[model samples]
Target: MGGQQPAEPATEELTIDQLAAKVGMTVRNVRAYAGRGLIPPPRLAGRTGYYGADHVARLTLVRELLDKGYTLAAVERMMSELPDGALALGVFETLVSPWTPTEPEVITEQQLAERAGIPHNPETIAKLVELGIAERQDDGRLRIPNPDLLRTGLEVIKLGVPLDAIFEMLPKLLDHADAVAKIYVELFRSTVWRQFADAGLPAEGWPEIQRTLEGIIPLAGQALVAAFREAMGREIEAVAYEELGVAPDTLPSTG
Candidate 1:
């Protein structure tokens, strides 16, 4: 009879083979990890060993670390230092990952040239790569890590802001941006990280620390944008008052 004898219950435990298949790992690797004490030993029922959700979580984390290029020894070190490796990984990822997440887009060299309105310009492409607006691929195409940033830069160039001038200002702009970033990071380090450290990094606190870390990125971006907007408005008003002899208050608002 081909009748499915009712599906396995959701919370049913898995055997070694079932666990291996569930997590996409070979039984051998699961056994090896278990032997190395990377995962907790399975529950025993007479002669049979059973694994549960905890085993799944641990194995999944191990696989994720491997995929992220961490060596076994490094992962072991991490596991030893942080029993809550998954939570720690969450905070680590939030801090190290790009604040502005975007889907990467790749373009052929011809497409790149067309977009920037500069035909056959390797130097321009190089500059774009240098600015991190694009990455030159092994296959001789450009990978735009941030397509929106690339489009914004192209629009600036269209507005007659010479690419060379933008390139010239880049170093100073980057240095200033770096300084601003340090200020924000320092603020967090001085307050949040310091308190967490002083508290001996209690297991109960990592969640709050991780949430604060996630929040700070958008907060920092918003603050920077607001500050820059205010500064730019003041500078433009001053320029109008000086050059056109119009009172700063009398200038017509573009908006």
Candidate 2:
């Protein structure tokens, strides 16, 4: 019934800098996104660009799309085809939520197959290499493509899921997670590493920092495990109850 935005004064428009700050992106990135058609082009007010609330909404939509499984290129195309903001946002969020990379690591193909408890066959090994989950080296042994994928795949195997199914989904999950990680990788470089170098931290200081992060690793892992156990228990119980048509409280006592 109105324009793409609510009734508002055009004079209240946000400049490129203002929009970038509001959306947690760099002005360069905002310009790049506009140039690449990731967001709608801003209105030109003289030599400067001005955006509105609608632009903010589009940025949020792009974030959600990237979080889901949409590549920037895919998002560019999808934005063109899909005019319904709410529906697109919902779909993008759902796709992005479950996808993330496993840490990168090097493990032999045989080791990978063994850990997954799947038969070690040349064909399967070749397939893993082809899918980029693992790669074959010059010495005729394969290593995991990424440490995160290695860890996640191991967890899935431990959960009793078939290796084939796990392999099938790994490619998709790793791709999305890796894409999301790009932003933080840049952040770490720009903030932590650069700041450390600027402070004249000795080369020896690097090892100490590694040790510090490593010391906290176990604590972080324990916290994650505790949270996972609680969440998984609740989810499993709810799913079982739904399937059995029984209330959680009405289930038979294990004791």
Candidate 3:
């Protein structure tokens, strides 16, 4: 077992600065999260207000999720779901973290062109930014928000797929991704998350919730890939048969 985190006793009084320092956060950030109702209101003592361990737990979760690339709005939404305002760190992480984790990278304009085999032009960069594949930081550099996606794009480009074709595909792909994401979110929210919320977030339910979610995340990812493989094969084969007048049954077996 790892060393136990030395958290403040539940009843320990903490000034705003002390609480911020204890949680390794800035006072401004703590207040911002508090304003968003991501944390419980501090207890007011006439001219002074004080935070406690509850604040620590909530802020810690918020900060951790944000560090994992979740937007603040998303963190606020997830925190708002917990009626009891308590969380198991592992369960929360399992619930929200991306299944195929991607570490983002920053690249120069020329590097983007070199790696992606595209021209180092403003129009080309604009297209990438528009596609949500890259982001333009204030420093005038490009950040690949999803490096795996960039790699995939580069592979497609290497196969002689024109950037225009890729650009055309990107929107449709994004639309489908959103649709698929919605389906999974709805299924899980309706079947699992809501039930947990309805149950008043029982203390004993944390472990079970964590285990169930750990299974769901990767299973969903695998399911998407498998389903797409099957569907893609079918679509391509249909094109070969219908458009190209190829006999499906006479084709050589790929497997």
Candidate 4:
């Protein structure tokens, strides 16, 4: 009775409704999360259960990670070994946040269907959602998570290419890209971040690293494009000779 005060709110104890509202979670979700140990179980206070802000904050983190394609099991592991907020925010800004944009543009399903030149069937849209390429908003609208990739898919479809072929190549392409990206990441970690930490200038390092990487990327892209063109030319020549019995010298050359 003495603990229940009129003007002073309990900082350590929040009612279920207050907890849900504060954490941006539904009451059902908060209870479910408590049951699943995603967040710590609330303490019993007489007839009412109460949670604290730490639980609310942790649950919010779990929800963010889930929205970023993390499984609950993975989130559990991450929560167990949580990094400093600065590092977490750095990673979030650098990697996770770039994938999702918040600009709202109104477009009908028919517009997307017309753009892709395919009937927008429920199954196809669902497949895109499941693949994490697109999202369905609570407002009954389709959110194109990455318009560039969607545009690429549309172009591929326009060229009469089957999605299965693209799907097969996509993983291989992404694996190669990831491998290349890791080299630079290591370079940054070793050279830039390490140097910054050693010099006690860690706060200023990431932006400098970002600037250096920004300069490196376009040059790397041009080199990659040139290498791919030459390599693909050689491949086409080899295939032509093997399959068609046509030598490059024997064919009419373009001047």
> What is the clash count for each candidate, in the order shown?
0, 11, 0, 0
Model 4 worst lDDT run, 10 consecutive residues:
82-91
Best by lDDT: 3
- State which candidate has the highest TM-score: 3
Per-prediction RMSD in angstroms? 6.0, 19.2, 5.2, 9.4
What is the Cα-based lDDT of residue 208 in candidate 3?
79
TM-score, every prediction:
0.67, 0.36, 0.78, 0.52
Query: What's the lDDT for all of these models?
Result: 0.82, 0.67, 0.83, 0.68
Q: Write out the backbone clash pairs for model 4.
A: none
Higher-ranked by lDDT: 2 or 3: 3
TM-score of 3: 0.78
TM-score-wise, the better of 1 and 2 is: 1
Model 2: residue 97 alpha-carbon error in angstroms: 28
In model 2, what is the error at residue 175, expressed in angstroms?
6.6
Q: Give one digit per residue, the lDDT tens place, for model 4 in 189-219.
A: 6975577657754544556655655565566
- For model 3, how does the per-residue alpha-carbon lDDT over 42-78 read when each residue is reduced to its tens digit? 8999978898877877887888888879998888777
Report the CA-based lDDT of candidate 3 relative to the real structure.
0.83
Give the per-residue Cα lDDT of candidate 4 at 64.
82
